[model samples]
Target: MPPTIEMTTTWERTCEVADLEPGWGEVALLGTHQVALVRITDEEVYAVTHHDPHTGAPVMARGIVGSRGDRPTIASPLHKEVYDLGTGECFTDPGLALRTYRTRIVGGMIEVELDR
Candidate 1:
């Protein structure tokens, strides 16, 4: 398990922490947007837009988790384009990107800063 990262900003509850399994990903609807949620570890969770930039398909939740050097990544299932989970930068194509969201666990629930 990784150390807890305390986020200072206010967070909106999205789902229960247990709703996502470690080492895997899930999709959650935030307002009208679809957010991809990943439980990378027992104490680490990441959220990003579920849309795959290359195909504009909501397929990121189905992406395979991986790493590029030290950076954690997820490859789009549709095109296999790799994207950094932390920055949403596409490693396969510099011109492409995904919207990253700040996520934190609070009271055993998953929360995210949707505006970020």
Candidate 2:
């Protein structure tokens, strides 16, 4: 079975390091904030708000994972807006941008530092 991550104070422990799959995104709820976690590689992971800035729909988690040059990105499923996984910069529309949170792998577990 896929391992799960439970909420904790300060840094929220996300899914197990193995729970994150390469080339995919997963959504985790910490209180009311929805976080989209993307696994680019075994050593890399990124977290962003699941809310699509264009349509304001919480569907970024369902967005397609890809990259522009060397910049990892997630394409909004609702409007096809692409956002930078590292900086949350919207490439499709520079005017609209998403929020990015800090992430790390600790002790074989994925942890996200909630952006407050």
Candidate 3:
């Protein structure tokens, strides 16, 4: 048997939970990657890639926040391509998908797990 390797998660502090308005998207720069931070409720926050896969534009911060059933979603501001905030699944187009990041709140600050 080979030696097991443990993966370490690096969480980057992005912003305060109060900084994000519910039902709106805000852009945060995590190193070289731009992330779209969305606040669905006071206790619920989500992070996704700001780059729109279909248009190749960094405009997801301006996307519309909505929901498909009980799953929270965000729609591209340019072409209206909807994506699942938690899974990064594109509902409108199966070929394209947005990237999602894990988010947590500590001391009222929002931290995102960088995709590595």
Per-structure clash totals for the candidates: 0, 0, 0
TM-score of each: 0.86, 0.88, 0.91
Compared to the true structure, candidate 3 yields what TM-score?
0.91
Best by lDDT: 3
Models ranked on TM-score: 3, 2, 1
Model 3 scores a C-alpha lDDT of 0.94
How good is model 1 by TM-score?
A: 0.86
Instruction: List, residue by residue over 1-116, the lDDT tens digit for candidate 1.
Output: 99987656446789888788876789988777799998887678889999999888999999999888988899999889999999999899999998999988888898898653
Model 3: residues with Cα > 4 Å off, grouped in runs: 1-8
lDDT of 2 at 75: 98
The lDDT values for all models are: 0.87, 0.88, 0.94
Report the error of model 2 at residue 74, Å: 0.5
* lDDT (Cα, 0-100) at 113 in candidate 3: 95
